[model samples]
Target: MPHLTCTEACGPDELQRLLRPRSDVVVEEPDHSTPEDAPPDAPAPEAAFRAVDGPFHHYRRTVHVLERHDEECLVRQRISYRLSVPVWGWFITPLANRELRRPRHDGTQPFWAPAERLDPRAGQVLGVLCLLSVVAGYLGTLLSQTITFAFDEFDAGLATQGNTLAAVRVGVLIALALVVLADRRGRR
Candidate 1:
């Protein structure tokens, strides 16, 4: 089972109230059997919240309210998910599901900051340029090879085409770098 665990501070009553209204969450009866490792002062969980929707729909999550101190409650959440597919199931599903579970900070922001901040339009243009560069390079290589094979000799003109392809690749790279730099500067 793959799981994600995190702790949050909120009173048991408040947490229960919050979970009750959420459409995806189902509150469960608190488990009476406390772990021996748990502190004696720690309160039993008031209720367990099971998240029922999203990418990890097959998973079960039990939210536990561990303790209360100075009006703040410590909550522990345990999520368990199963990968039913064969072969690469365990490896790929967990990674894909985890990515889906991750909160997207980009939200309604004009720019997405996955690694470097980039406007959506700029990113799309950059992606197109990159794809074009790859296709052009591949076509250039195929043409050069075909020409070489047909004459049983390498042609100097083919070298020019290769150079042109390389130049285009470099130009695309430079353009992408400039866009990133400009976006970073604009942020300031």
Candidate 2:
């Protein structure tokens, strides 16, 4: 998964006004516990919202107003979700599960880049390549296990092929890393 964050400045009143127009977002009950590691003087989250219905619901986006002091406020955004299919949810969900966060930041004016800016076509292509690499790696492992089970001995030929597959997997992963790095750099 890729990590992304950006900051914006806005007044607390303005932030609430902005959220008021979003029909899909519903305010959540406030959490009472303060983080142990947080400063003793740190303000508690003033409000929260859940995306119960919208395009964002697929991503399970949650918004938290972490603090509001004077005219400044901080907002925290989190998204975590897995695509589910009826009965065997656990088995299939892992493949598409995603968890990401945009941590709270205090500001006086709102600023946000389009989410699409963080996920361009190049990133999607890299993700597909990564998924293919995983499948290929799994198949290679299965093949090696089957050969060993049948022969009662490790097959050096199959081992060689597995090593080649491993190399290819590493190469694909490296390419994916480079693509993500380039994308991040381009955004900056």
Per-candidate TM-score against the hidden true structure: 0.34, 0.27
Model number with the top lDDT: 1
lDDT of 2 by residue, 20-50 (tens): 3233112222334443445787554343333
lDDT of 1 by residue, 1-188 (tens): 56677677877566665334232222122344554555899655554443333323344545576776867778776655553333334444555445424323333212222333333344355556666778888986786567546544544576765676688678779988998999899899
Off by over 4 Å in 2: 1-117, 149-188
Off by over 4 Å in 1: 11-14, 21-52, 83-188
lDDT of 1: 0.52
As a whole number from 0 to 100, the lDDT of residue 117 in candidate 2 is: 22
Clashing pairs in 1: none
- Error (Å) of candidate 1 at residue 126 is 23
Worst 10 residues of 2 by lDDT: 101-110
For candidate 2, the C-alpha RMSD (Å) to the true structure equals: 13.4
